[model samples]
Target: MREVAAAAGVSRQTVSRVLNDHPSIRPDTRERVLAAMAELNFRPNRAARMLTTARSRTIGVLAASASSLFGPASSLDAVENAAREAGYFVTVAHVSGPEVAAVEAALDHLMAQAVEGIVVIAPQQRVQDAMAAVSLQVPSVTLHGAGLAGDDGVFVDQVEGARLATRHLLATGHRRIAHLCGPGDWSETRARRDGFLEEIAAGGEDVTGIVSREGDWTAESGAAIGAELLADPELTAIFSSNDQMALGVLHAAREAGRRVPEDLAVVGFDDIPEAAYFAPPLTTVKQDFAELGRRCVARLVERIEGVGAVGGGGGAGSATGSATDSAAAPVPPQLVVRASA
Candidate 1:
């Protein structure tokens, strides 16, 4: 405070007021002190600051897994950025091993750190079950729509994204479309499959039952399922639950000598970075993981600030943004039509 005052040529009291964000300080004088502090890269000791104001300005993130897939990882980043901008420090714990035990350990670690709040970023049913077991010791929010079905959650509109992809297939005259769904434990997998099934039924076509195979959201798993789909002769179009799997499907199609869009088209969800450069330029639904991160932070901040969550009181809207807010929020997955589809 003294050094800032000396550098800015202001009184020590003025610098103190500026540092504390006192309303009594003149705007110009505060600006000078702040600029001087910035030039010196002066960061106030958080512990000292907290002594005066009982705020730790810290948040904890508990992730079921460290996999940076489109939803969980992206939302974690968004939450981190949001918390940082709001003047909060972040600590993250990546849970591993058995789902329930890992989550409990992660939460316990965060509790020891005394984080003001916590945000969970995993999408597994087991993760949700673990959260329920914890009873939310601190103000906590789940970024994915797991555990808190009736309560608001931050999630992408998976159902809408699936509808977009499946409707595109139907529009292209694909009647025998098959869905390569993700693991049954994920809420997104269920939502996406339901949306695809609903769209198929609404089209008034006799629904060819979804020839499904479970995957843990990996390209290898997709490839394994793709190989199986290739052996079946009647399948015309395939929508893998995610882009990684879609790429696997494309690989399998190439090996089987089937041409994309001519013999069998492919559509994938979560348009990952490399989807655009794939052999046939994968047609995929692009979801914003970064937005998920931001929402996580915002909601967590609300919990810390005692303002409650952003939407629906104590919770927020979908972490994946919404279908209608495509331009402004732009978190919903868009069908990036390409030669593959």
Candidate 2:
């Protein structure tokens, strides 16, 4: 504060007013302070400033796992940016594990700061179940939609994404298709598996020899399981639960003297940035995670500010800006066709 004030040739109080965006500060003076701040690369601590404000305007995020994972990590970045754009500060609390005690501890940490709202971005069932066991005072929402099924939840339609992948394989005439599933603990794993099964049954495909294998959402797990599933010569295609596993399956196919889209067709989920540059490229389901984040924040804000649901109520989230005024509905995923399938 002192450095910025000195650089801007203003008192510390004036600097404070600029930081707070007080209307009393003239535009030229505000510009001077901002330029000074830019030169000094100074950032005000919003949490510290919250003490003097009527509302802290902070949103808390309770993550059950490390933010390095693809799905939750991407959503976390999106949530932070969207929250900032909505004029709210974001505070994140990461749980060491999916225990009720951990969840309670994380909530307590956030509540200590008096966050106006909370977001749970981890997609694991254990995490959501643990969260459900605890009571919260502030408005809250989840991106996974695992435990919360109502209007308060926002998520990419995992089931529909799975159906898109499976339907593509089936329509391409891959009759003996196998499914590589993610670990059982995550809600997405179950939803995707259910979608694949639903499609197979709907297509009236014979379940006599079809198999579903579980992987740990890793390329190594995918490769090992892919090799095992491919051992059955009759299996002509594999729909992986995620892209990493699908990449692993590609390796397994190569080792088995099989070529993608020839000996076997492969489809994965998430359509990660690298999917398009894969060996044969990848046909996969693309989740609008950024849109999911925007919708989650919008839903939580609605509850916090009592603004009612976006687009009436219970509508699925769509891609847009100014999400607070848009629908907080479930974002749909699209199928990206590539050479893999």
Candidate 3:
């Protein structure tokens, strides 16, 4: 700002007024400031500006996956876009494990950065608890979290989404359906499994207990579990909790000489980009993970600005969830039908 003002032959306040688009600045002065800006390639420090206004303008993001995964990656992208639109920057931290220690480590890292707000996305119980234990000195929200309720944070409707996926298969005349569920500890996996079971019971299906296989939400795990599902003669359809596992199911079925939608139908969740390019394409449940990210950031911003209620900056005694509930809208889930099913 100093350099721009000097170059433009104006006071620093004049440059500030020009940047803020103040109506009082003359056209020539505005042009000169712009010209100085161009010459210096000067970009204002948004964080520093926000600090002057008593706002950090920086949001900290914590997720379980360091590498790319469909849900986490999409959510991260959504958060980035939304934050940029809202004039904020983001710092990301990854918790590589489902344990409390991993989550605590991630939380400590985020807090150390002095971020104005935080978003902790951990789908496992231990991780959720670890995050929950974090005293809310900074505004924070949790994504896909479980074992800790109360809309105090933001989250996706995992159970409802799984119900939609399961109901879709049943609606398509698949009675002997199987589920290849992800790791049992993950709240997402548990919610989806519960939803699938609930739907089956409601529909009066036999709810073949033996038809389900446990997977690790990975292709290899899916393929391994898929083999067991294939070995069962009565199985006619399968729903894998995630696209990776669904890919395994596809590979296993192909190796076993079964044609999708002919010998057996398959559906997966997350609807990853690659899902559409699979052997016969995968019919799956799609979660707006990006929307999840946006919502989380928005909530954090609201809390940081004191414009809305969230995390009362105390222990778990405060009721931040109730105040924010009206401000929060749950993101919906959808089904994408393709050749696989």
Instruction: Identify the candidate with maximal TM-score.
Output: 1
- lDDT (Cα, tens digit) per residue for candidate 3, span 1-341: 99999999999999989866689999998999999999999998876776665556678888875456677677778888888877777888898776667777877787777677777666666776676655656666666642235535566677777788888878887778887888776777877888788888876645553336578778999999999889988898898989999999999999999998899999899888898999899998888877777777776676676632442464323335445546665677788999998
Give residue 248's error in model 1 in angstroms. 0.4
The residue-by-residue lDDT of candidate 1 on 39-87, one tens digit each, is 9898888878778766677889888765667656667777877887777
Runs with alpha carbons beyond 4 Å of true place in candidate 1: 11-27, 68-70, 98-101, 146-148, 206-209, 307-331
The C-alpha lDDT values of all candidates are 0.77, 0.82, 0.77
| TM-score of each candidate structure, all chains considered together | 0.86, 0.82, 0.84
What does the lDDT read for residue 280 in candidate 2?
Answer: 97
TM-score for candidate 2, please give it: 0.82
lDDT head-to-head 1 vs 2, winner: 2
RMSD in angstroms between candidate 2 and the native structure over all alpha carbons: 5.4
lDDT of 3: 0.77
- In candidate 3, what residue range of length 10 has the lowest lDDT sum? 310-319
Over the stretch 1-341, how does candidate 2's per-residue lDDT look in tens digits? 99999999999999989887789999999999999999999987775777676568899998886666688788889999899988898999999888899989988999898887888876777887787788777767777753234424677788888888889888887778888999888888888888888888877645422555679888899999999998989898899999999999999999999999888999999988999998899999998888888887877776666623332222122212444545555688899999999
